[model samples]
Target: LEVATPAVRREAKKNRRLKIVGARGNNLKNVTAEIPLGTFTAVTGVSGGGKSTFLIETLFKAASRRIMGSREHPADHDRIEGLEFLDKVIDIDQSPIGRTPRSNPATYTGAFTPIRDWFAGLPESKARGYQPGRFSFNVKGGRCEACQGDGVIKIEMHFLPDVYVTCDVCHGKRYNRETLDVLFKGKSIADVLDMTVEEGVDFFAAVPGVRDKLETLKQVGLGYIHVGQQATTLSGGEAQRIKLAKELSRKATGKTLYILDEPTTGLHFHDVAKLLEVLHELVDQGNTVVVIEHNLEVIKTADWVLDLGPEGGDGGGELVASGTPEDIIREKRSYTGQFLRELLERRPGGKREAAE
Candidate 1:
């Protein structure tokens, strides 16, 4: 639903509540949600149970208009409170960071600039008067002229889709021979980019700027991804984590509010565990994280839960329960709680009688 400029209520408490009053948009039956600040909160339910409607359409949009001064009109809601507690609102989604192959993790996370500067400072580059610009594949001079720094040549066909083959000149290196000649520890700029996040971490261990950024990427469960892997080749979950890593690498302002929708999409069980650790780290640093989640593993570990359905569509949108996972399991009317009950009870040491 939608809300206008909400009135701010200053409180002396640390953990304040972000209350949504009268959210009646879509099938949300006048739902009023109270999300606490500085904690991990999950909005959980079956599909089409108004999770997006409550979090994105109403909360995020209203916050955007009020905080960032965006032109977005929130879904139907009366007012939102506790916005004064937040300085920033980031919706981390699966949308590509950049649509072109030219964009990669290093560039997106601000690691590429330092990497280029490091290369330019090498003795070989100094002898040739090569600058950071020379190390960049995006510019002229040092890039392979054949591919225009793309490393691949696109060929369009009349009836078939265009084809992209590695540039024969540089052999997908994207740089000229002379540029590649200047190396740090026997690896060219192209070679460094070709390394995975884990490899980059070890290669740049002495360089704080580059190492820290790559370390964050690894911390977010992306150790296997190439440092300069094209953004276009990333999955939605990968893209989302890349965005998260970029944010994490920045100086954290404890007041920022992060909203994510189904961040566990396409993630393996182990990866989900790693992703949760990173997310909890954000909250531990005193930031608030709200996720639109259906994953039981994620929801059960949340500090607070807002289960939004007794059922989906016309049968849902009302708040079935709002509490910790233990509290949710006691909710007989909640379908989520029933499943959660099984999960909680089936835990290694959980009591079988407690599940009933």
Candidate 2:
């Protein structure tokens, strides 16, 4: 009798995948594909090519409802198997973390709370009978009373645009004098917020809890943004990176599936490189990362590529090619493959094996 070897058994185990068959939602025309687990996969196509309908509407939505018990309904599909391996699914999109000036990166990531606690534990803060609540700009005690912690007073001119002038009490600093007096290593809490993420990382280096979160912000290419920068001031890409950084700071479970839509929407070449590094790191940690991307830089680096096309709109939605980047280049019907051909040819020894 023929017996399977250890290598064959390992290969068989690795070949286990998430199978989606006869997915006919929106523009997706009877799509069927098997995506490997514990690998970085990219779903690429042109505008109106049904990438979102397939990945988000079908895959992510289905997974969220099944694994996460989400109330939202997924698009129509025949079957989605192999979800038993996953514990949860997270969709990281480019939505703003906050709508008001009161919301900032520190507050969104829960890092500000610990930072405030650290400030409250300071020797000066203890002598002054201050608590963690006193360090918050959202509250009354530590914040400037004149501007009500807004740092700027908005004067509404009905006929003309609103005029926003600096706060007279704190001079644009949100905190009052007493709160500012509580310093750690010669820098107050407000001062720390004013510093860039890179500066904050260095400033809080001795404090692991605060330093690690700040370091994540820097790692995700947000080193230039201030810790206390207004949430409204950030662009879509910046907000997404902030969210990415927040997620990165957490201890990830290996069974989690991360789905990102157009992660490289507004990223520059350098920033894209940083983003790719972080994404691959996630996959390295045994988590599956699926991205709906058009950037060749991102697509080429993926362990597996699922190219959906032939044309956009009515003519598209079929899976034209599915394999490694090199395998994609061989498919004539795939527009993404046509573009990737040039990239793959130019870079010597860039061919990677497709994830099973």
lDDT at 312, model 1: 87
Candidate 2, residues 241-260, lDDT tens digits: the string is 88888878878887888999
Kindly report the root-mean-square deviation of model 1 from the true structure over all alpha carbons: 6.9
Question: Among all windows of ten consecutive residues in candidate 2, which has the lowest summed lDDT?
Answer: 1-10
Model 1 stretches astray by more than 4 angstroms: 1-15, 157-162, 346-356
lDDT of 1 at 4: 14
- After the best TM-score superposition of candidate 2, give how far the Cα of residue 14 lies from its true spot, in angstroms: 2.0
Which candidate gets the maximum TM-score versus the true structure? 1
Candidate 1 lDDT tens digits, 241-280: 9999998898888888899999998999888988888887
